[model samples]
Target: MRWVALTAVAPVAWGANYYVTHEFLPPDSPFYGAALRALPAGLVLLGLCRQRPRGAWWWRSAVLGLLNVSVFFVLVYAASQLLPTSIASTVMAVSPLAMMLIAWTLVAERPGIAHLAGAAIGLGGVCLTLLTGTAGVSMPGVLASVAAMLVSSFGHILTKRWNAGTDVLASTAWQLTAGGLFLLLVAAAVEGPPPSLSTSALLAFGYVTLVATALAFAAWFIGLRYLPAGTVGLVGLLNPVTGVLLGTAVAGEVLTVQQLCGLALVLAGVVLGQPTRAGRRGGSRTPLQPAPDKSAAREFSTRNPL
Candidate 1:
């Protein structure tokens, strides 16, 4: 419960990322924007953690970093450029479904029918809330967003696989540093000259680095450690909800009746996906890993028992 609550913080920050990027950040240099968001936060975190990846983890850290942070951020930012935040986010709503399949395959979790139903409902609700009846979407942007969701799903599973009993902070720091460096080189090569920042842009970048990348990723790893992959993915639908609410509250946009109803459905979907205790007599807990599984624990003991 505590980890779930902590993980929920990431969505709101991610919601703010869309708004800040669209409203304030440079549109043309997504690579640079991505690099800026990642590298600084990573360096700061690495400084604090003071732990280095050893042996196989060095490559594993790099792979996870590229999949989760560097490449994912660039793709997401590019999608935000071409698609409405709503459209991009709605596309991301499918993550729960994707994670369900991946988690079942990887971790051997058998979430009941309710979990699948919840994913479908949450995805539909996201569509209803954010679609806005737009007929045309940029094909490239849509593809990028969907690809982003897919890669991130895999990344989440990988995180769970490698995470086991590792220090969330140190692991996150390693991935960030590796991904940050990779993106920095790409940003330098393709992005050309860096854009000058106004005060607001600097502040927004600061917020992105601190809240969105640093704090959010930390909480995300914590959530992955505690919750099942599918549940964490389901909770991700809240990102779109936060984006929608932020639009209405901060951007002065008004919500329609359909959108309100859709929000309700999204909430219901999240609840439905959660594990519920069966009857008291011979009561059995539904599939949920409140902590690492046995294999994961063994891996931790063998790899790093310090």
Candidate 2:
């Protein structure tokens, strides 16, 4: 339950992202917003941890940073502009299947019936909860959304497969910093000068940086470190659920009967998909082995063995 809650925190905070992005943050500035949300939080965490990338992790963090954070955020923002939240979110709902397949292939972790069914139920619930009428979806938006799912799923599996030697906090901070730095350059080139943020925008950025980006990523990484990737992927369903519920509660949107039913299905799916001590069967995984790089290899072997 504690692990489940930790995984849930990421999507819950992200669910609120819909509200904050729409209501408070500066419009037409996804890059800047993403950079702001990530870079500072990463810096603060890195400062506290005072942990540098160990050996091969220098390259590994850059790769993970780009896929998990940089490109993922950029594509999400792009999809939002091109498609409705329902469309973008429902597309993303397929990530659990992707994560499962990747996990199976990479680590030979077989999916249990409960998790498989839960994924289907949760995905259906998400569709029911979010999609209604037709969306003005763009081709680019569809591509971006699909790409986001693929990239993030692969990145997550890699996070599980080739984990870092550092503590969860420092590992997460390193990736965020790398991703954030990349975004700073991209946002400058593509978006040009940063837009002036409103008071509300500033406040929204603060919440996203500290609570959403910093704390949320910490919980997410912890989940990835400890829980099965499929379970973590299922928890992502909570993002749209959170957004839909928040819309009803905070944005004066009407909640339909279908939405309520969908939420229930999502809950059921989550419950079914949860990882338990009884459920966790030992699976084949590649162990982290040491190499010539004493710092990185030793850290990977001793600290982050699969």
Candidate 3:
């Protein structure tokens, strides 16, 4: 139940990301915004944790950081600049599909027909939502966004597979720290000095760093501890759904009848794809072993005292 609540929090935070980026950050300098958002948040989290991950954990952290933070943020921000939020988000809606493919290939975890059909139907709704909007879509932007989402999806699956037994807070802190350092380097080389700060930009930065990066990821990791990778992936559809609805209601973006139909389809598909408690017990699923208890922590310290 705690995990379910934690998982539910991730999409709401992610949905707000679009609003922050679009309304607050300067459209011309996306990489700069990405860097500001990721690096600072990572540093803060790392400082708070103060435990350096060692050996293979370092490599694991770096890999997760690159996929989840560096690539995902940069590509999504750049794509947003080139395309409408709706179109960019619609492309991102394909992440569940990518996650499904990765799980089946890597873990031999297959979804039932209902899951597949629901994902397809939801994707169709996303397409309709994009088509109904008045803004012209950019093919390059759409492709980039889709690619970024696929990469992020893979990272999420890897987190479930590799870090299932690690402390959620510690594992997340390491990934964010490493990923943030990488982004800082990218920003220095590509974007030069950060842009002049504005109040709205600062707010956006804080929201991205503190709320989106720190809190959102904490919740996400906790949720993944309980849910299947594919189920968690499907929940990502809410990110775009919330973005579109908020864009329309708050930003006064137009929503046509087609978009309404699309929203309905997406909602229906998500409902159909959700896993019931009974299914979780009886279904052929990957077992997510919980992290070690306090006794194991004590044993590790006693065995390898620094």
Candidate 4:
């Protein structure tokens, strides 16, 4: 449950990010936007972890970085620019089922019936929340959002499969840093120069980098370390829930009674899919271990004194 709560932070921050990016960030230069967000956040986390990738982690970091950070961030930015907050987040709501399927295939984590039901109910709620004929839909935006979902599902599950006994912070930092560097090179080549930032844009990037990217990914990876992928995915239903409420509160969008019901259903799905005590004991096949070095072990203990 503690892990569930921590995991919930990622989706909530991401939900708010759709609104922030759509409203404040530059719309045109997604590569620069993604690079800026990933690099700064990666550097901050790397500063804390003070560890570099080892052996397979070097290539693993690059692969996960490309899938999870570079391409994922760019596509998400494009989708946020092209779609409304609620709609964009609702599209992402499908990730729970996707993650479950990918985890089953990639990591042998079979989905429980409860998880399947929760996914169905949660997805139905997301539909009810967004299928109202009020917002205009973009096919390209939908494609981008769907692409982001698939890429992230595969990347995250691959992380789970490969990250057995690895330090979450250090590995996450490596992925982010590698991805950020990749994005910077690509952005330089294609986008000519970085976009100018207004004060609002700077603040927006700060929030996106620190809260949404760094804190959110850390919390999310922590959850993946401790919980089943299906459970973590169900918790992610909060992304759309937060997006809808944020839209109503901040964007002056009206919250229909149907959306309220959808929110309830989403919450219900999340709660329903929580791992029981027995499940938690048995479901997590991999046990966490030290970071394969005395210095990293000391740093991890120093930083996480819990």
Please, what is the TM-score per model?
Answer: 0.88, 0.87, 0.89, 0.92
Best by TM-score: 4
Alpha-carbon runs more than 4 Å astray in model 1: 135-137, 252-254, 277-306
Which candidate would rank higher by TM-score, 2 or 4?
A: 4
Greater TM-score among 1 and 2 belongs to 1
RMSD value for candidate 4: 3.4
lDDT per model vs. reference: 0.78, 0.76, 0.74, 0.87
lDDT of 1 by residue, 136-155 (tens): 67889989989999998889
Kindly report the root-mean-square deviation of model 2 from the true structure over all alpha carbons: 3.8
Residue lDDT tens for model 3, 179-271: 878888888888788789888788778888899888888788776766666666667777778877877888777778898888888778777
Q: Which regions in candidate 2 have their CA more than 4 angstroms from the true location?
A: 80-90, 134-143, 281-297, 300-306
Write model 2 residue lDDT over 1-306, tens digit each, in one string: 687787799988877776676667765888987799889989988897777886778998899999888998878767765654445555676788788889878766676677788888988886786565544547798798789889989988877767634467777888899999999998999999999987888898899888888888888877876777778888988877777777678877677788788888887887777766654523323222211334545764344311
Sort every candidate by TM-score, greatest first.
Answer: 4, 3, 1, 2
Instruction: Give the lDDT of residue 189 in candidate 4.
Output: 99
Q: What local lDDT does model 1 show for residue 246?
A: 76
